[model samples]
Each structure stands twice: as C-alpha cells, then as structure tokens.
Target: MANVYDAEKKVTVNVLNKEFDLGLMIDSYGNTGFRLNNGVFVMGPMAIFSKSVLCWNVRTVIDITPESLSAFYLLEPKLDILVIGVGNRGDKLSPQTVEYLRSKKLGFEILPSSQACSTFNFLNSEQRYVAAAIIPPTNVALNLDEEFDAGYRRQRNLRLYEE
Candidate 1:
C-alpha cells in the first residue's frame, strides 16, 4: 500500500534546463498569504516584481485603483506585464483601473490567485519583466484542511489494518 503523508506541497517553476537567478520566486500561497522561495511568509495581499516583493494594501478586487497600484507604476524598469490575482474567484477589474494601466502602457492579465501565481512564475522564468499583485484566496485554507484531515484518517486506517 502506498503511504500517505500530510505535508505541504512544494511549488516549483520548471525552467526546462536553463538556469537563471530569478530572485524571489513564489514558493507557496494559502488563504493567509504567500511564501517566498527564501522561506519568508508574507500575510495578506502583496505585489511581486522580478527581484522583490511588497505588501499591497488592497484587499478585494473592488479596492484596486490606480492609486493603490502606485508602486507598479513607479517601477524604474517598467514591467512588461502585470498579473492581477483577484482572490478565489476571478473577476474583472474596474474600467477606470483598466484605463489607468492602459494609459501607463502596462500589459495586464486578471486571473484567480492560483493561476496568477503560475503565470507569474512562468513569465518570470522566461526573464520577462513581470509583476503580480495578488490577493489571498478566501476559501483555500478550509479546503486544504478538509483534504489533509481526510488523508490523515485514511493513513491511520491503513496503519491499523497492517497491525
């Protein structure tokens, strides 16, 4: 029988044999927030650039505004794309915010937090100037807990049967 281990899964970016020192890849994310490759866990919303990460103030998609995104706009080396992680369920940005980004000539993609993390990792691996503003998913922690509990129970049952 296969052993079941209740451990946090490691998230990785597949660079396909090319090695690059892409600083600060997102290691993991949960309902609380994100964990960086360097093992630092940041709580709440955040903004991630190629080399650094910053705490973002906005909590929900509706809270996102041009003012809230000042950090991205003022980046010296302008980002090629800005990925917006709009919490658990994907939602469209406000028209005004969309216009603001377009006026700054910043390319953008809006996705659920999980997909946003993947997209950011992929683009960053390619050495593209990419950034991400992500809101922690609302339902992830509860779902993870349920799954972990179920796995633990199954493992315990297997151990009992073996004995």
Candidate 2:
C-alpha cells in the first residue's frame, strides 16, 4: 500500500506486498466502490463514507501525466483491462487519454455509475481491475473506508505528498 500520500489524499499500493486499505463506496442505485483506502473521499466539497468500515480491492496507484485519473488504473493496469464508472445517466470517458490508452492496447469498458456496483463485481470476476475516479455526486456520497483511520483522519486533508 501507499506509504506516502499525495496532497489530494491519493496513495499507491504495492501489489507485491498485497497491501491496500480496502474501503467502500456506492452509487445512487445502492452500488458500492471499494479500495485499500478508507474513511472518506472528499474532493472539492465531495465526501463519502459508509456507516461502517468497508474494503476495496485496490492494489496500487501510479502517477500519470497531469497526475489525475490514476483512480481507474489503481484497480488495474491500463495496458491490460479497464472498467469505467461513468456518471449518472452515463458520462463521457476522456477521449484524449482514452485514445492514447487504446493505442497502448488498453481494453476499455464503459458502464454508468448507476451500474457500477454490479459491474465492478463482474469486472473483478473477469480479472479486469478498474477505478471510478471521475464519478458523479452519487459516487461522492459513497462511503469509502480509510486505511489509516486516526492518522489519516487527522492529517489526510492536508495537501502534501512524501514522494
């Protein structure tokens, strides 16, 4: 798991170590999102947390250009498979980066957040890891579990990274 967190509260997981926090997140249709990290995912006034602790299957997150959107690949590698969580009513995947991803032999699967929960399970079963970085308000309301509870809760909100 990510020993160092970025200012945005993002972390990198070590698949070799099999280390991750495994948190929970859900969509409007009562679907959930999960990863190794927990607590809350708050970005620009968005925050989500479950009534209890939950876990996601995120292994690690890499730093990409512009340093955003790693949330998707965090679940799987871009060159292998992908499961996209489009916003409510369905949203557009990033055409620019997506084409580049395709050029690199990445397999893209689009699904609305409305169906993210079920789709996530399917993808996991198919061994296609994915992340829903750019989701909707429903996604925000999702309850994510923070790996480092007290430590993170007290310090995660600060904008800083250890590299």
Candidate 3:
C-alpha cells in the first residue's frame, strides 16, 4: 500500500466519482466509520441526512447517511474492496475491525491520503467497492467541473475551507 501525500496539489477522492476535495469523503464500506479533522463523522439515511440539512438551513451541504455507507457496502454490485484513510490518528486499524472485514471477505488497501484514493480508483474502477476518509461536509469545496478529467475548469480558483 502506498502512502497518500498530504502535499500533492490535486488528488481524487470518491463517494461516487472522482473528487477534488478530501473533506467530503470517508472510509466507508456500507457502514465503515472514520475520524476526520479532529472530530468523527458518520453517515445514516437520506431522510436523516435531509433532516440535518433542513435543520442547518443556514449552510450549503449534502445529507449522507450510515445507511448510505452500509448500502454501498451491501449493494449487490459491490466489489470486494476496502480503503483505510489514515491522517488524524496514527493507530493501526484494530484487529477486531480487520477481522470483521475479513469475515466479509473484503480485499483491502490502506491509504494515508488522496493519493491512495486515486490509486484505488485507477486500479479498481471496473469494480464498485471503494472508500476514503475525510472531515465533514464543508462550505468550501472543489466544484465537480473543475476536476472531472476533461481538464481543470479554473486555474487559480483559491477557495477557503468552509466554516
């Protein structure tokens, strides 16, 4: 497993497709959990996520749920895959967790950051299962058009991390 570099300018992270912002992703195989930016973020159902979104109407965001993560893992088209995003914590993914994943017969790759996210995608695009780690929904983000593979949409578009 190669290490994901924190300094790289552009790297792709995925929830469904390639992403330029690392904050919007998490290491999820249906229901996997992760630590991002000092706090923990987990997903549930669209209804619940939607409620959170409605409750926080002051900001722009998306509702992602634990059910979403679990559905991703349990989806019929699932690929036997696993991704570990390592950043906030240096501890090893516990043996219990690894054992549970093994029980599910998942193939695995652990990554340090976005580089690993890209490598996993490039290697497994034909299949479906993929995951990543990230902070939470951010007000600041990279627009899809800017990094969608045709080419960069904006060259010097500097955006701040959302509050």
The residue-by-residue lDDT of candidate 1 on 1-163, one tens digit each, is 1122344542222112222377667776776788776667789999988778889999888998989887887877788999999887756679998888889888988898878888888899888999999998776533465557667777787899999
Candidate 3 residue-wise lDDT, 15-91, digit = tens = 43333333332232121222222233343211111012111111111122232234335645555564543322232
Query: In order, what lDDT does every prediction score?
Result: 0.76, 0.37, 0.34
Instruction: Choose 1 or 2, whichever is better by TM-score.
Output: 1
- Point out where model 1 deviates above 4 Å: 1-20, 141-163
**Total clashing pairs for each candidate:** 0, 20, 9
Cα misplacement distance, residue 115 of candidate 3 (Å)? 3.8
Model 1 / residue 118 / CA error / Å: 0.8
Superposed by TM-score, candidate 2 places the C-alpha of residue 12 at a distance from the truth, in angstroms, of 31
lDDT for 132 in candidate 1 is 96
Model 2: residue 109 alpha-carbon error in angstroms: 1.0
Listed per candidate, the RMSD to the true structure in angstroms reads 6.0, 13.9, 13.5
lDDT of 1: 0.76
lDDT score, candidate 1, position 126: 88
Candidate 3, superposed: residue stretches over 4 Å from native: 1-72, 124-129, 133-163
TM-score of each: 0.74, 0.38, 0.35
Scored by TM-score, the top model is 1
lDDT of 2 by residue, 102-127 (tens): 65455655555445444544444344
Candidate 1 lDDT trough over 10 residues, lowest sum: 10-19
